[model samples]
Target: MAPRSRNASAPTKPLLKAPAQIGSLDAAALVGELRQLHEDAEDPDIERMPSDNELYGALLYAEKHAKALAMKQGTEAAQRSAAVKRVLLWEYLREQTDLHQAKAIEDARAVKAEWADLAPVLAVSTPNAAYNKAKRLQAARLIDTAHGDRRLRRTPEAVVEAERRIAAQALAERRAEEQARQRHQLVLPVAQRLLGHRDGLAFDTDAEDWLDEMAAVVDDCHTSTQQVSLARYLGATVRALARLERQTGKPPATTEAARLAYSAAVELLSR
Candidate 1:
């Protein structure tokens, strides 16, 4: 028998995944699909396939089939089919488990989990055992083409590389947050003006919904993508309030503050 590489048969998830279920899926059919998924993972154009939940459900059914095979409850052909399904399912599960174990270890490290803390949880003898295990998993590089392992050891260089990747990912997230804060400056005055009059600022029934929505939308705008649409709302409010100022020539105090917010909004939009 040949020794299986930890990542050889593990497949990357498909791009567009649906809910995975085992409704009426039998062991025979699942075995065929298990082979197909392994093959499809090698194909660059594979855009769609069954997700992990489907395979997990199939493995549960295969377990039942395995019990029947043990009791000699099926015919020779049926027993052979069951045995093959069990083998394939076990192989798939083993590969998937290794990939996820590496990820879980990476996640544990993110929260400052030291090797000493991980040893007992990983069922390893000592902190060094845990460190060695992480190093081996880190070498696999499954996301890279499945040609060869990077063969990274638990040296300072290898640990630093992993830590660098983690830090870069965290920096990307912080950049996203920073960009959103800058974008929301476009409506920050509108939010503040409305908040200043936390009591309803609507001068009449017609302006009520727009005034309330302008404030709420700015408050809820946490992402850069959402800022553009919310700015349009603030712009419309400015036009409406400006018209109200022209018509009445003596608008209420809250309306006056909203008009001031319009000036701030104009400066932000010009930027």
Candidate 2:
């Protein structure tokens, strides 16, 4: 008989590891390595690249290995290697700083921060200077191409494109925020009503003790992110309640308000 095709087989290995427990890593060991490396091979551009964790780690690893290699060379060659490394890093950071600075300005404007507030931080003498710097950085990020090494164009057309993009982003954020607020306002009352019967129906039986904490959290919430847990808790609780009710010939809620709340909570579970 011919052997079965390997591709069609169920296979010999387990498909999952539940996160695959391999060699373990810890933060203290990684931080110790970076701290030691920084003592000798410090790169100032590391701070400028804070938004990119993966890139920062890769650069640090590359630096560690390359610095070891450079040390094997004579002193003069090592110095030259270090100089080239710094210059190449500078070129990369020069491009990235403009992009990140532009994003920071957009984030500041999103929170209604004024140029006056940003002037000192931007290292500028006046609010006008700060605003102009923001515009320049903003334009630098959108130019079609770099004119030369360290020379990025800020043409009128690029500035217009940047302005349009910023405006659209701000508008979308506002609309999304408003929609979240509206949805929260609508569902919040229903959740509160369901919790109103919590003492009489929910706590009477041995349901999870977390309902108490969830009630307090929902009561104090102001944002949609904070409010998500209440709906999720309610949805899960109602499903459990339904299963219990079906297994025994008894309803989860006996009182009129509670019966209504059970149905209401279940109906909005998918929402």
**TM-score to native of every candidate shown:** 0.42, 0.45
Among these predictions, the greatest TM-score belongs to 2
User: Global lDDT of each model?
Assistant: 0.56, 0.59
Q: Model 2, 1-271: lDDT tens per residue?
A: 9978666422222123221121233433343444344335444433432222443454555454544433433445544554455445445656577779889988998999998999998999899888878877765555222222222234334465445655787799888878768767766777788788864454324344445645767778787667666656666677667767877768878788888987887777666
- Residue-level lDDT for 52 in candidate 2: 27
Candidate 2 off by > 4 Å = 1-75, 96-173, 202-210, 267-271
Tell me how far candidate 1 lies from the true structure as C-alpha RMSD in angstroms: 13.2
Model 2 whole-model lDDT (C-alpha atoms): 0.59
Candidate 2, residue 11: Cα displacement in angstroms equals: 48
**Candidate 1 lDDT tens digits, 202-230:** 35544555666666766677656567567
